[model samples]
Target: MLRLTVHRHFSTSSAFFANRAIVYHSNGNPRSVLSALTFPSLRSPPPNSLNIKYLLAPVNPADINVIEGVYPSKPSPTKLNSDNVFVAGNEGLAEVTGVGSGVSGFENGQWVVTGKQQCGTWRSGANVNVEDVIKVPKGASEVGAATITVNPATAYNMLSEFVDLKEGDWVIQNGANSAVGQAVIQIAASRGLKTINFIRNRENVDALKKQLEELGATHVTTYEELSQKSFRDKVKEWTGGKPLRLALNCVSGPETMSMARLLGSDAHLVSYGAMSKQPLSLPTSLFIFKNLKSVGYWQSRWYTERTKEEREKLMEVLVGLMREGKLKEPEHEIVTLGAGESDEEASNKVRDVMKNIMEGQYGKKVLLRLEGE
Candidate 1:
């Protein structure tokens, strides 16, 4: 549990007054472009707004691309002190410290997260529109609430939107050790759906396999294992010839195509990422003969297209899973930046972690704790 105080309003002399953020002036490599900014004390929110203080924010791989100006959705430049900059962070868990007039659903101390994309959530506190945020159950762990808006939502949505999956159904995917992949495995298992999970061969392959299997993966193997002439035969034996109706691809390339080939007729191949930085290739025969359907998924677009009530319902279901222990928090490490630190000091610390994240130095998910605790 997090130990922190939520103030309804800020006074200049109070420790809660200062707000710090990770901001970038231009698009470039993260270490070069990312910086920290501290602003004056926050005031009460205006009508239909809420004063939110973030508790935990995850450092996702997409965050790096957004900083480099390569992602499709980018945050608008925000004013921090005298400088206009893009404060970084797409997802976080926040506490409502102050509610504005005409805001009837929220009050001080309730936890919430934004339903809209590119919320600029890295800052310690801000005034956000009430309609843009959704309440998270207080029973949710801080990390689960912070990270839920993206990966788990993507996993759940992909499984549900693409296919009419039923119990004993089979699903196949590559990049099976990824955060989203792990969520897919767990969610599928809860529904009695089996998963054929594939990952790159790593040094600790055996240990990795055990970890995923413990999470309920039906079959876990390396991409190289797919090369075996009898691999399809083995998959058939596992599923008893049930059609693999869905394939989730994050690492696109020949590896993904190989996974897709195992899907039966009229199956859907839903791709959400391309970690390999390689183009996907599939013989026209797969489409003409097998009736394979390929489509791309973006969680940001899903949020934009859905109604606020729909989004709230999705959160309600996910929070229920968290409380029931059907969902688990991803492996993570939190990088904390003290509010009392100088801007240069805080910026340097954030940049160092960004550098490490870009280099794949952190094997687990990286989360940020910018203000208290």
Candidate 2:
């Protein structure tokens, strides 16, 4: 379907090497964080692994972080040949091309998605343990392929993780405008839980609040309004004394303190991101007198270490909602890959988009699409 060359080793400061790629390539070095390119191998594995041909892969901030050396979750290299090292992408919807001699659950041409508890997420194909891939639902949309790893799972888990929030209870969160935040609002509402979402006032605060409320948010307030004591009082009255039990956060610093105070005694406050990138300042009294908790939620850690059967169940529920069109993927920029695309061409396109984020004008995730889907 497509052809290009690429390198898989990271012996230098640059994240990965690029020879050429079926995806794209830039001349010499790349300006985008992804290596000049990454390529799939043609080498044969010892009879026990399945060869996958990936259809779609998500380009997340964490994926960018991995390329930048900021993310701790890095894939170890595997020997494919004397010259080529194996690079794997963790989350992508793929199809099986070659089944191993002993593989049981899959056959050639079966559509699958990698759920291997490791990262192999950027390439076009993979050779993995047959037990590692999960069958994707039939007729799964191509556009929905690359977008389901961390945020959606985080939104699903955090709500049900530490507490069993009853129908009338409330869960508040900062960064309520993010994709995860939107998912949290939707899922919580489906369970009849109320949400008090907080966000930085950008364009159309009123409109944003209305949109979130339509998704079942109880209230959508901004960072500035968070400081007033009356706002907390209003939240208290709004909950009608049913108790605010959870706070899912990304922005910390001052907002954390304010949101923390809004919770009932022994309420759980889970911080998922450092949007402010500032350290959380906690008052000892919140822990001692109010019995409030400050917990950090890293979705990858949970995905790797927590309950699998349960997690898969949640994913099944999520995918069903998506199929029904009640839940939709975020709006994102798509980088096309096809019959004869170059790594540099893809890199240059991504560089422009990253420049947009640095300039504070970009929103939504970016997905890389492969040919022959």
Candidate 3:
């Protein structure tokens, strides 16, 4: 049975219900600042709200950057036991368990993901405003819905927003093995667009290349290949001298500049992240003579700028792709918090995972399942 309560007070119930949130009082190192607390559980949804139980949440790099106070957007502090604190997740898949009196169109057992940005989804359960979440179709898989809003959306938008790519047209991008990068490969393949994917050379690079190619990548190479002038001729040969119209960059540095160099006149270079933590420098001749247009894309801003209906439409398209198997779930691992665990044990477990993620030990996406009892 689940123990039930609200805020700091406990409410009598025949069943036992509880809520545990991974929160940080101050922004700093994730391992040092992140801790677990047992917040009150919802007995019923507040007016115009829906009580939601989180099913799965992912520990994205942006979540860690938010805790480090480096990301552009910040999560609004959540009210818990009369005090406000920041929860540590940005994306999650949840199930509605209770609906407030004034709320309609939602009921128990509906699956959803937050429509709002930086929703602080790292909790077992909470009462969320109706407008904050978008419904996930029943056909969508748990992983697809849980991880949809950020990476896949970013990939879909970046591909269409910057350049008007057509079938057989070539696109170039760095970080070809990143989550968004992989999605780019698949989505482009679905649309008949070709991608020249680039990544850092690694010990298992051959296997990694094979994996990406299996997902529909036209070509997979490393930055080492991009550094060679000879490789530019090879890329030219692959595209039959057709200008690469779009360049997607997440890792910024000399490699990004090299990737941009492959673009032809009037091409657009869209950047979404700076994993290299270095400045993006390019030659003036490229921008002046080549007419290269440089731009940045943030998926959060895209949501804030659009209407609820528009957001749903995008989700509808993506979910349809998911149902059709055009877009596959990201390669990931789940980090679970058992219901029987103590707050200390849960906090330690999360911290250990964050530590590994920070150190680049874990290559695939990491999801979280925090069970509160």
Best by lDDT: 3
**Candidate 1 lowest-lDDT run of ten:** 1-10
- What lDDT does each candidate get? 0.86, 0.67, 0.87
Worst 10 residues of 2 by lDDT: 21-30
RMSD of 3: 4.6
Backbone clashes in model 3, listed as residue pairs? 2-16, 2-17, 3-16, 3-17
Which whole-number lDDT from 0 to 100 does residue 202 have in model 1?
Answer: 83
- lDDT tens string, model 1, 1-373? 1111221111223243378888877777889777777777678899999999999999998888888888888887776666667888899999999999999978799999988788788888888999889888766799999999999899899989989999988899999999999999988888899999999998999999999999989989999999887999999899999888899999998888888888899999999999998997887898999999999999999999999888888888888888888889998999888866666777788989988988889999999898832
Q: Per-residue lDDT tens digits of candidate 3, residues 137-176?
A: 7668898899999999999999988888889998888998
Give candidate 3's whole-model lDDT.
Answer: 0.87
TM-scores, one per candidate: 0.94, 0.84, 0.93
Residue-level lDDT for 288 in candidate 3: 97
For model 1, the local distance difference test gives: 0.86
Off by over 4 Å in 1: 1-17
- Clash totals for all models, in order? 0, 19, 4
Candidates 2 and 3 compared by TM-score, better number = 3
Which regions of candidate 3 are displaced past 4 Å? 1-17
Clashing pairs in 1: none
Minimal lDDT window, size 10, model 3: 1-10
